[model samples]
Each structure stands twice: as C-alpha cells, then as structure tokens.
Target chain A: MCLSIPAKIISIEGENALVSISGMRMNASLSLLSNAKPGDFVLIHSGFSIEIIDREEAEKTLEIVRHIRPIK
Target chain B: MYPFEQYHSKALCQALVDQIHLMADRPLRFMEVCGGHTMAVRKYGIPSLLPDSIMLLSGPGCPVCVTSSLFIDQAIHLAAYDRMTICTFGDLLRVQGTNGSLEKAKTEGKDIRVVLSGLDALEIARQQPEKKIVLLGIGFETTAPTTAATILTARKEKISNFFVLSAHKLMPPAMEAIISEGIPINGYICPGHVTTITGIAMYKKIVENFGIGCVVSGFEPLDLLQTILMLVRQVKANQPKVEIQYSRAVKPEGNPKAMAIIEEVFETVDEWWRGLGILKASGLKPRDSFQDFDASEVFSLPVYEISEPEACICGDILKGLKKPQDCMLYGKNCTPDNPVGACMVSSEGSCQTHYNYAGIN
Candidate 1:
C-alpha cells in the first residue's frame, strides 16, 4: 500500500495543508516536511505530505529521457 | 499537463523499452521489491515490451501479502472484544486468518472500521472515546512515518483510547534476507515511496554487500521501464550500483523529518513475514515511551497458531520461486472477489495484479 501521488499545496494552516491532487482537494499533514509552502508540490501518503517534489529534478529527468536515442 | 503526468508519457516509455531490448544481451533476473512497482509493471504490461532474456520477479513487497496469518488472527481476536474497534486499511479486510477474515468478523457485527490513514483511526478514537481504537498498522517505511505521526498526535491531543497493532516492516532487511537465502536476483527495482523516506543508503549497502544493482523507481510506466533500462545497463557494464530513477520525489538523504518521527516512535525487532519467515530487525514496534499506544502491550491477546492453506502457493510466489499461474487456484478459486491467499487480496499484490491485468494489451 505504498502508493502515493504528487499533490500541490493550495494552502497551509499550522501542521495541516490543503493539497490539490488533480481536481480533488484534501487536507494533508505537513508534520513530516519542514519547508512545504503554498504552491509547492509534495508527495501525499496516508494523509501526510511525506516529501516535497523537486520540480527542477523532475524536469531534468524528463529532459534526459527525451534525449535518449533508440538503438537501431 | 499535471506535473506527475510527464512520467506517464507513452513515447518516453516506448523509448526506454526499446533501449532495454537493445541493451539486454544476456539473461538477467531482476526483482522489484515494492507492491506498487509490481502493480505498475503489470498494469502497464512492462514485461510484454521487454526482451525474453530479461526476467522480472515480484519480491516480498506487498505488506498485506507478506503479513503472517497469526497477525490477522490476532487482529480478529482483538475484534471480538465488544468495546474494541479494529481500524484497518481496506486491503486487510478480506485477508483470511485461521478462523475468518475481518470482513467476516464485520458481518458478524464486530466493531471493525476501514480507515484510509492512521490519522483517520485517531479521528475515530477522538469521536468514540468510550471505545478503544486499535489501528492495524501494516506497511513499509513509506507508511511507518505516518503511523508514527498519528501516535504523536494522539499523545498531543490526549487521545488515550488509540492504539496501534503494528505489523510494519522494513524493506532493506527483507531485501537482504532474499539475497542471503540464495535468491537468484541480479538487480533490484527498489520501492520508490519507501526510498523517499529511507533514501539510497540502505540500497547502497545492498549493492556493496551483494554486488547487485538497484534503481529506486516511481510507480509509472516510464519510471519502471527507465529503471529496468538502468538495471540492464548496470548488468551489461558489470557495475553494480544504486541509482535513483525517481529523483523528483526521492532524495539521497531522504526525508529526515519523517525518519526522525519513525525513530522516535518505533524500534526494530524480529518480525514474521509469511513467506520469508522471521527476519531479524525487520519489524517495527512502538517504543517503550509509546508503549501505552502499542496494541500488543496494551492488550494481553491470546496467541493463535495459524498455518498457511495447504494448496496456496502464495509463499512460493512471494519468494519469486513460482508465479501466480503456477498456483492451481489462482483463477479458479482465488479470484479477487474470493481470495484464497493474501496475495490475491491486496490490489497491489502480484496474484491480484496478475489476475486483473492478465492478457491485457
């Protein structure tokens, strides 16, 4: 049951943050994360924001995959 | 486009598959150590795209699948108490114990609640202060931190009725156990979510000790294919190292705050895995400071000796020794609607995933 989705934080109030996954909004706890803020994307697992997603790193991975030429 | 949808691009996945097909020259057996990875691989038909030389085995990753029957039996026993409410994940509802499942117990009017998160269980405790709430904690490191957080919240809010029957397991020790048991695995597709909390250090240790490559992967088509391609490259170069293909969510050091919560609330001990048996320091339990929240300590429950069904090969399937097809009851008797074993019960489980996506394009 380790399935988690990347959710963007819409707002934060104390240890709880309102995160939007796709179009659905839910409350996620920021107790596990130190620097999560509004508009930042975080991985939500079991009602908690486990980690903040690194957008730069994500784009870099996609960019690297985009450049991989298929072997003939 | 949604930020996570980029990893699901069909074109990127095909490219990685093409690269894997071109690079996989020799026979290599790789095992994915996460149930989420297993589901994604089957759902995306990843094996259909790969060369026959590259074999992928599902590891003992599904927490529900690996949980011993005794744990289920104990939970069932606890459910018999009139003043007790057993809060568990939805997947655990149908998993059969020695006598019956929690679903069966619920039908017989037991106080069983299906909670999505441990915090939901705490909320149940807050709502029903007259009854005791015992959360059936089952998962790897990806989930343990959340349970730890729930316990801390219970203490902070003075929720005395909340308890956790922790069946939480660690991924690295189980990985090490599989290797030490002489499983013929060349590389590993590590659990992406677990690594988000534990980081790559444990995987680095696995690579150093067993000289096998590992790739922490996300649960998507492109992610699995890319991870497989990375592992293939490592095998081709004879260089075993740990890589993070899911670097967007997982970092090298992982989530230190999450780790800190887990360390504060729980301690490792020998745990029983259905297939792997008891592995040392593989299970998590609430520490002495949190003993009041520990279900095992809070209640003196009777130990019930339980055995796996004689016909089910879930244990073998978990060890990567057999496939779901190898089990005679896989389709005939053990459909998801009526699961005969733990593997067929959880959606992330190999048997259930195989049953659902079998022969799919």
Candidate 2:
C-alpha cells in the first residue's frame, strides 16, 4: 500500500505545477493529469502529481497527517 | 479501491509476509537499495510483518547518505565567500560535517540558499551578476543530467557568475563495491528512479558478475512486494537474474537525450562515498571544455578534512552493517531537529526513515 498526500494546485506550467499542502508549497508534476487545474487537489508521489484526489480524501489525509505528525 | 483496501485481494504486505514465511528457513537477506524503498519499507512496518528468519537489509542507495564528508566541507567553503550565493536542495542544508551544517552557516548570516533545481540556481545567477552563484550539485545519475543541462544552458547564455560544486555519483559502481565486500545480500530491490534513467539492462552486468537476483521496483508497497516476490522466485529456481517491475516508467534504453547531455558536459571519475570509501569511476566531473564552471578548481581551496560525530553509526548504517535503531545515538542523540549525522538530516535517508516512522518505541 502507498500513502499519497493530496495537495491543491496553487499554480500551473506546461507539464508541472506549484502545489500547496498544509500551507507548504512544493514543486509537483502535472504530466499524469491533464485536466488538473488551479484549486484542484492532486495526489503527489515522488515529486510527481499522480492523480486528482477528491476533497473528502484530501481532508481525510490531512487529518491523518495531523494525527500522525510526520516530519519534524 | 487501492489494493490495500480490497477485501478479496490480500494486501501486498500480507503476501510479502507469506513469502517471507516460506523463505524463513533459508535465512534470506534482501536489500532494498533505494532511500525511498527504505522509507516505504519502514513506514509500512514491512519488517515487523515478516518472519524474523528473513532479514531485510538496506544499502547505500541514498545519494545524500552516500555523499562524502569532503563534499560537505567544500560546500561550506563555497558558502564562506563574501559575494557568493550557494544554492542547494533542502536535504544538504542539514547534513552535519566537521565544523557544522550549511544551515548553521546560513543562520550565522551566510548567503546559502535552498533551491529545488539547478534551473532555480541558474535563474538566481542570471538575475544577479555581481554575486557568484554556486550550486551544490548532489545526487546520483537521476539528477546529474538535469544539472548537466543547466550547465550547458549557462554556457550558451554566457553566465559567468554561475558555477557548480558537483558531487554527483553513479549507482552500479557502489553496488558492485558492496557485493565485493561480502555484504551477504541474497537479492536486491533496485532503485526505480535510477532504473528509469539507466534501465534494467544497465544492471545486466551486475547480475551476471555477482549472481545476485535483482528487481527494479517502484516506490509503492505493491511495487516493492511484487519485486520481492520476483526475487524469491529467482532464488527458489536457482536462477539469479535482473527483472523490471516498474515498466510504466522505465525502459530498457532510457532517455538517450538525457544521457547524451550528461556525456556532453561531464566525465566519470574516481569518487569517495561517505561510507563506501573511495570508489573508482563512480563520480561525475565537469568536462575539460566546461572547466570555467568548475567551482573547486576556480576557488583553489585546500583538500578539506572533515570528521564525523563520535558514536554516530552513520557509516555502518550506510553500508548495511547496522540499522538506525542499532546506532547508539539514533533517536536519543541524533534527531531530525538537531541531526548529529548525515543520514538523519536527509529526507531520503535510512536514519530519517526510522526517526520519522519506525521510532514508535
């Protein structure tokens, strides 16, 4: 099983985008999801945007990370 | 549904546990040689799921973990310049050397900047001509070509302020060193990102020379489990081979254009890894034509001698001789907040993996 976090696309480029999650902005890819736009939530994997995650799933993941408190 | 959530389909983890159970009698030792694999394996509690007889070992797959002390010292030297802007990835900022970390220097009012890519560093140099912009180039083959491309772009655009302190390393050479040193690795879960660039065919020589079963696996749990299963099959059949499970991203012949760009700008040379010692032809050096972009030569700094923290087992950890918990100062003395060792500092490091997910006790 894989744990992919959902992040909102804050901005876009040709094949990449700047995504935000829990107020942290990181470079994410938009190659896999052509329909993804700003305000869309995407599942980021190894710096690549894998899929467009639903808002509910994104909220659940945020809850889990908040509970787990991963990273320092 | 995600494979882990399926009722009828057993979790890939459970399948892996079952395989480990079957192979427990033989005392199998499989090494996942990617930092991402190390994190995933520990994050999902893969070790606890398996039988004790089947030991999962980690290797020197972490590019940040494998980078030598001298490289860090060079970075510190470059950052000391009055008008220098040293740009690097976030991970390198925390890796502690003899004196201190790049972050510590930055905190002490150095102009060390954390950048995501060489492109970012190039942009900084392009924008500011009065300041010398030096990018601390770190990573294996997967990241080298990108940096190489940036260097070529700098030359084309005639950006004199841009330079790079290259610490780029290759993987297969290090793998060969580990095997030759008798690390007792029965099988290997190869790095998917490196394989995506080098391809499964690049590992053909290793399998032939060492008779080790290898499978190129993705970063996900299913990908790891499938690769493990494939390794088990190879061992059971008495046929050591290399297999590719991440076909979606990797091809036999990887991106030739990227390889060409790398060849155009850099040359393979002898290099030192943090724990692996000096490995021949395992490092990238800027081509003779690109000498103007070489930071080390331009600065004329003396050979830097950096010492490690006493009681830190980062060297052993990188060599697969010990785990993060096995280190005397893993969670207690060295931590993500105040890292005493390099492994704890880098996100794609074994000690960081343990500290982040496996330090439940």
Candidate 3:
C-alpha cells in the first residue's frame, strides 16, 4: 500500500475523483482530501488520494535534472 | 505502456552510471528502508549501474513481511468463528501463522476475502450485515489513516459489524533501532509515501541523532538514482541531514489532514516486529474513543508464540546484517512459492525482489 503513483484529477464527482495516470483513469476516494480540484496531481495509494502534488516541488526536481551534467 | 519511461530511459540511466563513476571513491552502504524502493532498485537493475564500491540494503519495509506471526494467528482464530469473514490484503494470505497459513484456512472452508482498501472491507460488512467483518489492517503510516477514515465512516453509519485488527507501524523507531545497533549504514533512502504523510521534517531527529544522511525519493528510476547521488555527496562532504528528493509528493510539513485523521482513530502502541523485538510506541492501536471498532477488543484472540524457521535468517535480513544471498536457505528451500521466511513471502521483500529480477540459485 506504500507504493503510490502521481495521477491527475480529470473530474471531481462529490467525494470521489476520477484520476488519470498517463492515460489510464480510475476513481479514487477523496474523503480525506480537503479541497483538491481538477487538473491537480495527487499521489494515489490504495484507491485513496493521499496528497496533492506541490507545483514548486515538482519544479525543484526538474531543476535538479537540469543541473545534472554527463561526466567525462 | 506503464508510463514514466522518459525518466527511466536507458540513456539517462547510462549517464547516471557515468556520473557516479566520476563522483564515487570509497565503498559505501545505503539501506533503502521501504519495500517499494527495494523492488524499484532491483527491478530497474539500479545495482548494476553503480560501482562495486556502493551497496544497497533492504530493511523491514514490507508490512506483511514484518507483521508478527501472533497477529496472523489471531486473524486465523477469528476466521475460524462461524458467520465471520476476514478481510485482508492479498499479501497476507500465504503468510504462515502459528499453526497454518490463511490460504490453508481458506481451503478448509473459511471465508477469507482479499480486499484492495479498508473501504472494501466496510463494503463487505454493509452487504453481509449479519456476519462479523474484520479488516486486517496491516501497514505503515501510509495505510493507517485510510483504515481510520473507514472506521469513522462505519461509526457514523452506525455499523457495529465492522472492526479492524490494526497492525500498523511507524518508520522512525525502526530506523532508530537499526542505527543504535551499530549496523554501519552510511545513509538511508527514506520511504517516500510514509514521508508524504509524516513530512520530511520528522526525519530530522534521526539524522541529528545518528549523524547519517537521510533523503526521500520517488519510485521512478531516475528519482531513486538521483537520491543515491545526493546520499553519496552527503557522505563525501561529511554533511548528514534530512533532505527531500521527492518534494513533489512530500513537503516539509506533510499532509496535516491525513495525520489528523490517523490521530483521531488510532494511537501509538508498543508493536512487535517479526525480526526485531517489540519497539516502543512503534505500532498503532485503536484509541479508546473508537473502542467499539477495534476487532481485538470486541472479540477475544489468543496470541501464539511462533518462531521463524531456524535456518531462515530473516531476523538478520531485516536488521540489514545479512543479505538474502548470505542465507543458506535463501533460494534452496525458501523460494517465494514455499517461503520459510517472511522476507520471501511478499513481492516487495528483498529476497522476493532479488529472486524475481535475477534468478536466485
């Protein structure tokens, strides 16, 4: 249950949200989530949206990737 | 396609290997404390990418693997009662209890249901209102809140038929236990999902106490490799601190609502790990307010003292003292099909991961 994947919320229907990972879509319970909206990336674990991905943190990982240079 | 190939492409992995070769010098051992990380590292052949100087160790990460046999025995005793259905994750079925495994019980006409989530068990309870439904809630922080939320729902709906035998554990205590024993671990690849709930800041205590580098990373291959790079650099610079490589999912503060929900339904209790003896306040039990929803409290269970196979060496494996290969029974008698040790039972277990990726002979 620890294994989680980042999925984008395609639509919100009450407490359940239809999240898409790549192109595959599945409905996850957002009962624990407070105010997650569509287009936000959430960490899906065991059919529950545990955490919404932070944009700045996503950029930080990208920043690290940009800094990495191939060694000689 | 499963996706995320852009981050795990062969070209990117090759470059990461080259970068490690240029950067690394002396030998280092890093223990990945999550089963998910262990599977990812072995599945992607990440070990082959690194120089021989670097080592990766797997800890007691799998909840199914580390759950004390007494817990399983208790579940089996519950299953024996007529008009009772035991719900659990698929990983818990083949686990051997004091007398026999859950699969064996199922074969003997016991109703054991494998569920995807704690809510699924609640659903079963709702459908079969007459039967006593017990969800075997076993996991780390990642799963406890989900079970908690389900129990709260059951209480609100006035459903007394549902109860949870919670076997959830916290990660930091186990980390502290390992470090205190002088395991010689240089750094830790902290669990991403657990950190997502508890936050990266919670690990500061461990880093401060042990003076070892602790970092969180995602499951993607590039993310794991990048964290390894960060860990090695920390060792080289003699800078030991907590960092988050998986900041996208994990923040410094963590998910407050999730943590609050876990606090609502369950409280920390002394938990017995399969290999490691009972760690203080390491496990979660139902709070007194939610006593009616606790399966163990509602129903009496007899605990059994079951020792692991003498030759298994799972205890040493969990403590990071011995690799799966170090055990004589690793492949010869402890195959996943017929697991003598708990470590060989789950897909995330180091032995199972190694056996699946590279043929264990």
Candidate 4:
C-alpha cells in the first residue's frame, strides 16, 4: 500500500531507471515507461512508471508525499 | 532535517495498533474505502494486529470492480470492429463481458491495445489516423484529470480519430452511498490517490451527516495502521471528523489545476455501477465542447441487459455486505485462472486482494 510519486529521472539503465523524489533517490522499472525523457516527471508505481506526472502537479504531490505523517 | 526513514514508517504501525487496542473495550466496524488500502491492510496483517475490537471491511474502491457489465460489453463491441483500435489500461482487458472479454476479442484478432495512460491512446490516434482509437476511460478523480487532459489536447489538435468511452466516476458519492445504505460502517479510511486530486474536503458531507470518522490514508502498511488509529481515536472520543493521515499527498483543498481541467472537459452525470445500481450524477461525461470525442455520439451500442454469470458474489463483496469466503464460489469455482466475475479478474479487486494476502484458508 503506497502512493505513486512523481519523480525526476536522473539516469536510465537498460529497462530500469533511477528517479529522485524530494532529494531521495530510488529505482523504478520502465515496463510502462514511454514517451518519457530525463527531465520528465512520472507517476511511478510498484517498480514501474505507469503515467507521466504533470510537473506542477507532481511537485505539489511531492510536497505532500515527502511529509505524509502529521508534523511531530 | 526530516526524520522518517521509511515511507509509512514502522513506528506509525505499532502506535496505530496500540491505539486501536486502547479503544477496544468493544468491537468496532471500520471500512477501508480504497482497494489498495485493503491489499495493504491484509499484506501488513493490520486486521490481525487488532485485539478483535476493530473490524476492517473492503469497500467498492476498485473502479474495475464497480464498472457495470454494459461498459465491458461495449468495449468488446468496439474491439470487434476491424478499423477500431480499443485501447485500455491492463485491468479492464481480462474483465469478462456477456459473451467474452477484450482479451478474448484480442485473441480473436481484434485490435485491442493496453495503454499505461490516456496520452498513450492519444499517441496511437496520432499514429494511426486511418483507424478509430477508442480509449476505455475508467477510474475515479485521480485518473479522470489525465483522461480529461488527453481529450483537451485531442480536441485542440482536431484529432477526430480519437474517442473515449467514459466510465469515469467520482469517489465522494460512493462513500455517501455506503453510509446512506446504513451498512454498519463505523468509520472510513478514504482513498489516498482520489483525495490527492479531490482533497479530503470531499468527505465533509459524510462526517456531517453520518457522524463517521473519515481518515484519508496512503496505501502502505504503516499508512493503514495509522489511519486505523486515527479512526479509533475519533471513535473513542465519539467525534466524527475528516483528517488527512496521508498528509504527504493530500490537503484540505485538492489540486486546483487538475480540478480546473476536469471541470473544463467533463461534467457529472447519472451513471450505473455494478454492485450499487445507478448513482445519480456520480459519473463523468464529456462536456458539450468536446462532443466530438464522445464515443456515444459516434457509435450506437445495442441496449443489452446481460445477466451476471452465476455464483459471482462480486456485488455483495463490493458493498461490504459479504466477504470473499462468504461467496459460494470464492476459490472453488472462481480463481484468478478462471474468473467468473470482474472482482477475480481485476488486480485491485477486494476478492483478489483477500485471496492473495488475507489468510483465506
């Protein structure tokens, strides 16, 4: 149970890619990754890029995803 | 520096379980409205962690689960046409129609394509100008904005070859339906993705009318636990409120730009749901401005009231009226290999989630 986050593509490996979400780096599968380039934001889910996240909206969602728990 | 190590942290999970136990002077019924939450709760054993004081039931959160038989049949019809390219997300492909499914149509040499996004369908239309590209546009608020954006772009480019069979739905109305029916739901763990766009404000009416606690949670073990804790706290206090436990992605006010785009291209209309009948003004249809992209205008589907196949208790499973095991044909007659209904076929389905994660022995 995880929310799909819009992350930046820092680099790509064969069919896999490295994405940066809120300065934290993670790897996601590119099985559904298409029409996407290095600068594009994508809604990655379960080790795959399902859809390209809108940049402005992605940034906003990141703001929320980065801090999901109540501010303690 | 921000302090959480893992997303939906383990500390949150334990704390949530502890809180639920604290409120367990008696048994409580809680419903997780998103199918993703159902899978997470089972995967993390959230239900088992409780001291029999809390009961979590899966709701009709899976869009594929709620999509009526008519929509599936229409998709098969479009796929049967030689010049029609029916593009859809993966979940809908194997969903059975009256006679067959899109997967069956594809096997029969129909042009059925699986797309990751609505834009992928748009790209197909751009590439195959000679063929009519029909996208099975299904989902709640989260996916609707993308579909709306695709239509906006298509209309701007005058892509007459592109059309969408919109089965898109809204979430809040469904939540209301559950409470209104008085299905013995004490609280709600709202859908994270849908609230990301529509915001937690959508559940205001539920809190006001039914006096049930609504916590919007992410699809994670810890997220589910924390949300359950939130619900328990509200229950203990005897206060009905809406809170954002998945605060990382949702706010009181949702994505304005996405809302604007959706409002621009689509309007709420009375639509049919599978388990729940026609929910008045609960579905999204293309606005008059984008009438060209409305598949209903271009194609005429025969009115067919197809009967649901025998022993498929998907409807009961969806409404929280029954569990997957309660069905006469849960694992015996209807496994994933041979799905008698949509719930088994769709990966996000409650029955499939329960079959996979929940100890259904």
Candidate 5:
C-alpha cells in the first residue's frame, strides 16, 4: 500500500496539482503539501503529494549512487 | 537502462553485502512492514545475497492480505444487493470472505469493478447514475488521503450513490502488535512510501518503546542494501533509533496537509486485522456526519464468528513467527492460482513473494 513515485508538478489548481512522471501527466491533491509549486519534485502516493524532495539532497544521493564501484 | 540501475550493479550490491557481514557480530532479524519492500527484497533476490545469519521477515503490510473477514463479508454483502456495484483495487478480488471471494461473486453475476483509484469509483458513479456505487476503500495512510479527497469531491459534486466501505488501517499499531508478541525483531526496514506520508520521525516512539532500530528505506536495490547495512551497523553498535535512509522523499515532519485532509473525513478507531486481532485505534471510520457513505451503516447483515481456511497459517506468517515454507499448504495446495489464504493472493504478500522468488526456502 506504500507504493509511491516522484513526479514533477506542472500546474497548480486550488487543492490539486498536475504532475508529470516520465511523460505521463496525472492530477494529484495538494492538501498534504503547502509549498509544492509548479516545477517542484514531489513524492506522490495515491493521487496526493506527500513530500517535496529537496533538489540538493536528491543530487547528493544521485552523486553517491553514480560513484558506486563494483566489488571484485 | 533506468537511472536506478546503478544501484543494482552486481558490484555495488556485493559491496553492501560485504559491509553488512563486517558490521554484524551475530545473527540479526529484520522485518519489512511494507508490501512494496517485500516485493523489492524478493525481486532482487536480496535474501540470497546476504549471509544466512541475516533473516528478513515480512510483516502485515498489504492491505488486501491483512483485511479482516468481517470487513470482507460486509463488502461481499454490500456487493450482493441489487442496484449496487462494488469497486475495489485489483488485489482484493480474490480474497476469501464468508461465502467465497468477490471473484466468485463476479463470476456468479455481480457488478464488481477493479478500480485503479478511489476517484475512478466516482467516475463509475457518474456513468451509472442508476446504480449505487460502493467503493471498497481499503488501505493504509498512503491511501486514506485519496479516499478523503474523493469524499470531499463526492460531497462537493453531490455525487449520491457513491459510498465508501472503508476498511483502511494504520501501520504503527501493527508494528506494535508484532513487537508485543515478543517476535524479537532486531531492526525494521520501514516502508518507503508510508514514511513519505507519515515522515521518518513517527517511528521514534517505536524505537523508544521497543529499543529496535527503525530506518525508513526506499525501494531501490541500492536503497535496500544501504538501509540493511545501516541496520546491521546499528545492531552492531547497540544503538537502536529511528533513522531516515530515504530522506529524499521523507521529512522529519510529515505532511500535515494530508493528515488534515484525512481527519476531515475519517477518525481513528479500533480495527480488526486478519492475523492480528482487534487492535485499538488502528482503523479508520467515516465521521458520523458521513455515515451515508459508510457501508456498515448502509447494509444490514447478520454477524457471526469468522473462520479462516482450515490449514492456512497466514496469521503466524504475517507476525514473522513462521515463514511461508513452514505452512503445509505453501506449495502443495496453496498455489497462487487457487489461493487458500490471503498471503498467497496478493503479489506483495510474503507467501507469494517467497513462492515466486526464493521457492521452497
């Protein structure tokens, strides 16, 4: 039941927002987020934006992941 | 390849396994309470990657798998009524109720639709204005907010006939249920998406009370390996605390907006689970004002004691007290095609996960 995906918000309308994952656009409720404006990356669960992921933290995690060296 | 594939690199996974081996002083038991995580662990063959000393247990995370018989019977009863259509998630179709399963009812002529989300039920209601559309709302915090939103939508649009048979649940109480049973779980790989809605800090009380290390983890292969290594290190250090391994999605302070939305439509109440008995304040009930949307109040049915399938040990399996292999029905009579238990019905369920990935073990 905890399945979620990170989607970028493209538009905001009252308590709902439009987000794009890959190329598909879906409407998500913003009742759980106060500042997930357009262009922000938010973690979406069951048609609701639950968390606004920090860009710097996401980059840092990605950087660390890119540096992964296989154990021989 | 997907960007996340780097974490699945054989070298990276091997390195993480080596790190866990180095940090571990003795055998450790870890429980993953989310069905998604259970799927990830099995999909990646994570158990085989680790030392046999590290045992991973699956907990009561799947909503369909953990749904109580009473709730299912009520849903079945609601679906059987004339001029009513029952909408539910795909996983709930095969779950057994008192008479049988919704699938059986569907084959016997019932309007049971597998909806992608709660809002889809609203759409169904919009199309079939003549029928009563009862959405079988069942899930955890991750899903309650969606139902709450649908309730607001239904109220605003005056979408009559669109009612919710809410059997939603909470996760922390189930964790407490397992802990209270003295299951001896050393650490937890908390559900990734659940923590996003609830935040990583909510598990602090669990750590404080039980002294078990809890870390909110993402579902990626690297995320799982990283969190498992963190748990092993915590176990080695004897420092049990709640940590956030999936910080990118989870915040220390969870989304207040979502919780507020949920409160607008529902309230916490004592709920009964499939394996676990009635847990206090573990389920959601529609507010008194919204009783029109409650199926229990809408449908009148006789109450009787619930009896599970004779030989299934799903209760013990859900509590981590026994593995799927421990059940005599695991593969013999309990195949996924014709499931005798809830655990075998859901893809995220422990029994199904084990049976699909690491068969017989």
Candidate 6:
C-alpha cells in the first residue's frame, strides 16, 4: 500500500500536475511539495507527489554501485 | 532506459550480492518494515541470491495486513445502514472481519465502493448530497498525507457529506514494539516511501535507543541488494547508524509541507494492529477541529470485539517469528483468491508475496 513510482511533471494547473511515468500520463496533486514545477521528477504516491527525486543523487548512487567489484 | 530502471540492472545486483556474500560471514537477521520491500525482496528472488547466514524477515508493515479486525467489522456494520456509502481501497474489499467482509456486504446490496484515492471519495460526496460518504482511510505516513489533503479539499469546498474513518498509522512505534519484543534483529531496512514524508530523524532515534543498524531503502532489486550489503558492513564493523540507500527520493529532513498538513489535520492516538496489538500513539485520527469530517465521531457506531480466525498464524508471521508456510492453511485453504487471513488478502502481504513468488505451495 506504500508503493510509489517516480514520474516527470508535464504541466501544472493549480495544485494538480500532469505527470508522465514511463510514457503514461496522469494527474498528481502537488500539495505535499513546496516548489514542484514542470520537468521535475517526483515520487507519486496515492495521487500526491510526496517528494522530488534528485537526479544527481540518483546518478551518484548508480556510480557507487558500478564501482562495487566482486571480492576475489 | 529510465533513470529508475538502472537500479534494476542484473550486473549491479550480482555485484552487490557477491559483496554481501563475502562480507556476511556470521549469522545476521534483518527485518524490512515495509510491505513494498516485502514484495520487492521476494519478487526479485533476493533470498535465493544472498548468503545462507543472512535471514530476511518481513515485519508488520503491510497496512492492510495489520489493520485490526474490529475496524473492518465496524466498517461492515456501517455498510448495513441505508443511505451510507463505505468507500475504501480495493485491498480492503476482500479482507474478512469477524462476521463478514466488505465484498460480502457489497454482494448483499450494500452501497460499498472501491476508490483509488481519498479525493475520489470526496467526489462521491459531491455527487450524492443525500448519502453520507465514509472513506476508510487505511495506510501509513506515506498515505495519510493524501487523506489529509482530501479532508482539506472537502473542508474548502464545504462538503458536509464527506467523512473519513482513519486507520492511518505511524511506523516508528511499531518498529519499536518489535524491537522491544526481544526479537534477535541485527539490522533494519526501513521503509523508503514513509521516510520520504517522515525523514530520517525517527530512525536516528531508533539507532540511538536500540543500537541497531538501519538503512532506508528503495524497492528495487539492486537497491535491496545494496541495502543488505550496507547492513552487513554495519554489523561487521559493530558501528550502528542510520543510512539512506534511497537518497534519490528520500531526504534527511523529509517533505515539510506534507508533515505540516498531517499535523494540522490529524493527531496521534492509540491504535490497534492485528498482530502487534495496541501501540501508544501509533495511529492517526482527525483533530478535534476537523471533527465534522471524522467518521468515527460523526457516526456513533458499536465497537465489536475482534475475533481472529482459528489456525491462521498471521500474527506470528507479522511479528517475524514465523513464515507463511508455518501456517497449516497457508497454501491449502488460504490462498490469494480466497484469503482466510488479512495477510493473504493483500498482494504486498508476506504470506501472499511468498505464495506468489516463492513457489512454496
């Protein structure tokens, strides 16, 4: 029940925003976010965008994972 | 590939698995206190890849699974009233109370509706001015904010017919209850989405108070593997702290706007969980100011004594003491199609997840 998916905001109208997730577009409420705008990737949970996904941090995490070599 | 899809790379998952196998030399038990993680762990076949010494236990995190039977009974009782519509998430429809389920009531000519979000319940209220719309608000911190937003919207629009029967709960108290139960837990993989709203401060308290390692993790194969590796590293070094493996979505401070809305609308109260019993201040209810929208307050309903089904060990499974297969009725009588217990009803539930992915039947 706590499942949330990452989506990109397509446009904003009042407190609701049109978000695109893997090419599927839907409306998400921006009430839980303070400064959400178009083009921002956010975690959509139960119709509300809970948090803005940080792109740099995401890349950094992948970079760290890529550096993990198998222990010989 | 999308940015999130990279976290599911098989190579990255293998690397983390290798690292975990190498480092985890001793027996270590870790619990994931989120239903999403429970499903992800099993769906990704994480246990088969990990070392034999590391045991992953599913804690009481599935909101639908942990909701007390009395609440369901009360909701069912409310559905019996004429001109009263009970709106809830789809998962709650099949969950059995002592007497019957919402799905059963629906078949008997009750006005029960399955809604995707709390706002949809409010919309129903707007459409049917004569009927009273009661939204069964069930979820943790991740979903409570949406319910709060719905209530705020209802208040703004002056929707008097709208109400919420809040079964929303907080995560930390339940985690503390589990730790206090003297379970031999070495580390914790915290709920990532809940942390996105509540932040890491509560986890820091857990680490400080209990002296255990905790990593807030995302629900992906690579993410779960990396989190296990992080936990193993913490146990090996004997230095326990709270870390965020899902930093891309979860922040240390969390979403302040969401917190403020929850604070304004709801207040902490004692709530009943299925297996864990009552934890002090673990549940959320509308504040006295919003009593008009509070379903429990608006409707004077009889509280029914809860009676869990016999032979169902969902309680022990939820407390991390037993697996789904431990129950005699697990695969034989209690399957997802016909769930005898609450744990078997929700897809995110440990029993249901195990049945679906583990192929233990």
Individual DockQ of the candidates?
0.80, 0.06, 0.59, 0.10, 0.47, 0.81
Model 2 chain B: lowest-lDDT 10 consecutive positions: B1-10
Instruction: Report lDDT (CA) for all predictions.
Output: 0.92, 0.76, 0.87, 0.77, 0.84, 0.93
lDDT of 6 by residue, B282-313 (tens): 99999999999998998888988988988999
Model 4 agreement with the true structure over A5-69: per-residue lDDT tens digits: 66778788875689888788887655443456776666665345545544453244334434444
Q: Against the true structure, what is each candidate's TM-score?
A: 0.98, 0.82, 0.96, 0.85, 0.93, 0.98
TM-score of predicted chain B, candidate 6: 0.99
Across B45-156, the per-residue lDDT of candidate 5 in tens digits comes to 8887788889999999988888877777777787779899999888889988877999988998988999877888898898889999998888898888889888888888
- Candidate 1: list runs displaced more than 4 Å: B359-361
Pairs in steric clash, model 3: none
Q: Positional deviation of B358 in candidate 4, in angstroms?
A: 2.8
How do the residues B1-361 of candidate 3 rate in per-residue lDDT, one tens digit apiece? 2324456666665666777777789899999889899899999888988999999898888888888889889999999887999999998898887678898999999999999888889999999899999999999999888899999999999998999999999998898889888899999999999988888877888888889899898888888888898899899999998988888788788888999999999999999886788999999999999999998899988877866767888888888898898899988888988887778888898788888997785
lDDT of 2 by residue, B1-361 (tens): 2222221224434655566467556668899878878888887676776666667888888877877677877888878887999998887888876788888889989999987767789889999999999998877767777678788889999999999899898888988888998889889888876765566777888899999988887665656665776787788888999887655445566656657778999999999887788899999989889989999778876687757789988888887898888887878878888778888887768888888887724
Candidate 6 CAPRI classification by DockQ: high
- Angstrom error at residue B49, model 1: 0.6
Candidate 5 CAPRI category: acceptable
Best by lDDT: 6
Candidate 2 chain B superposition, TM-score:
0.94
Q: Specify the poorest-scoring 10-residue window by lDDT in model 3 chain B.
A: B1-10
Clashing pairs in 4: A1-B219, A1-B220, A2-B219, A64-B248, A65-B248, A68-B248
True contacts kept of 5: 0.53
**Reference contacts preserved by each model:** 0.84, 0.00, 0.60, 0.02, 0.53, 0.86
Worst 10 residues of 4 chain B by lDDT: B1-10
The root-mean-square deviation over C-alpha atoms between each candidate and the true structure, in angstroms, is: 1.3, 7.4, 1.6, 5.9, 2.3, 1.0
Q: By TM-score, is 1 or 2 better?
A: 1
